[model samples]
Target: MADDEGLSNEVNLQQRHRKERKELQAQVQKLKHSIPKGDKRKKKEITEQIVKLEAELDQKQEKELEELESTTNEPSKVAEQLESLTTVDSDDVDVAHKVKENKPSRAQKRRDKKAQEEKEREKRIQEETINNLMGSRNVESETIKAILDKKGLQLFEIASDGNCLYNAICHQLQQQGTEASNDSLRKQTADYMRAHQDDFLPFLTKDNGDIYTSEDFEKYCVELEKRPVWGGQLEVKALSHVLHKSVEIVQAEGSSLIIGEEGKHCDSPLCIVYHRHAYGLGEHYNSVQPKSEETVDEFT
Candidate 1:
């Protein structure tokens, strides 16, 4: 009975100890709640430990993924290399599906046609400028023909549009890339200007600010010893809005054959280029007007 009593006392003591431990745990939880969370160094250390454990878990997952990929298909690695080196094969049987036909469409053709038309218009303007310049110089057909031949501009081409003699010839030379000397062009241009200065020829405006007319320019032409040669023409259009005002010549008629109007332009018989020579009129001749009556009396 005493032993039994002793066992009961021991059991009671154990139950009390357990109760005390429970109370101590409650007090410990209350104390933890009373302390500020981020203020304590030990709390920071516990958070760091938790983060470290999570990182370790993430590493384990990645290692599993890598292992799985390594155990899978043999071509997985080689597929990347093959894709890098591969080009679409034109000859392969099924490649027709992947091939793209690059022929221009109807719309593209229309655009090209419009572009071609614009180019043709610009080229036409350039040709007209050259013609106008030639016209002003009174350059003759033969001289012009000679220069054209020298420039390798003797050929003709059939244009889908109607072609001009000048355009056809220049086009042929341009296609052949003929070597035309600038000096020749200039010299020929000048020679023509001087020879026909009397015919109210157009000139590149001379140093003097004067304009000449087609008829009255004969007085100046009388001074030229050589017949004029026609060189190609050049039109001086202003880089800006104004266009085609200036003409250029290497030599001028007389001091200047610029014929702004016709005064002495009709003074020619053999030379219809001018109306009449100043010497052509009997009014100016010593035989006709007789210089002066005083000189006539002295002679008598």
Candidate 2:
């Protein structure tokens, strides 16, 4: 009787485990399709979660199979015990069977329902967040593209590394018959900022809202020159003066910003798009280029 009960428990446990595994597999599928393409960071996070769940499933399955096998091996002993226990009361047998079934009581069922609801709510929230992020990027990209279309220009995508701003500027310069390396641009911008500290120092503030000291400014310049730090409006203004060209920042909304327009060093400006939410990591920039014949035809 004990052997039979042990086998039954093992079978029930395996069934529960299978159900859990199936649910996990469904979650993995949902996650795989939840986000848009080009979101490498989010995809990586989901992949890690899927790997963890699969590992857990494999471990549980192995242990359950071993337990089930051990319980199944004593069939002959179970048969003898069953024959001897035939004289037991039918009502007692029914009660024993009910106990072995291990059905959840009302309290457990309520708790389980509440937990499942909470899990579902969390999943919904995750899906919504990803959708919102992707939607915002799509809208912003489209808006910027519309503006570029008026000028016969389109977005030239740049890598999302910290050097996107410098890379974009280099791409524009190269298109204009000026080949400048990103490293050189960074150094030039830093040097320009260092030389004109008064022009930039007033705009910079510490964490406590105090003006940056000379030492703080030096460290900032070093970070720009040696590190892959992201460049912002300050760096853009410095680059405009360094490159002797007005830098125009196009955006999805509001009027475009033209830096160093007073310099009037060139007939045309170096155009770049500024994205606030296009990339999940943070702000990004892409070069604006004139459309080629093939691209123009496709757009038409």
By lDDT, who's the top model here? 2
Q: Model 1 — which ten-residue stretch has the worst lDDT?
A: 235-244
Clashes of each: 18, 0
lDDT of 1: 0.35
lDDT of 2 by residue, 213-236 (tens): 999999999999998788999999
Per-residue CA lDDT of candidate 1, range 1-300, in tens? 544654575566557656755665565565556545323345455556555654564445445444443433247545653465467554652454344235554345655875898799999999987985676333533343344344333212122111121222232233345433323333343344555454225553445766655443443333221222221222111100011112211121222122212333322111001101221111110011112222221000
Q: Which regions of candidate 2 fall more than 4 Å away from where they truly are?
A: 1-81, 90-142, 149-157, 279-281, 289-300
User: How far out, in Å, is residue 274 in model 1?
Assistant: 13
lDDT of 1 at 253: 27
- True-structure RMSD for candidate 2: 8.2
Residue 109, candidate 1: alpha-carbon lDDT = 62
TM-score of each: 0.16, 0.63
All models, RMSD in angstroms = 39.2, 8.2
Pick by TM-score: which candidate is best? 2
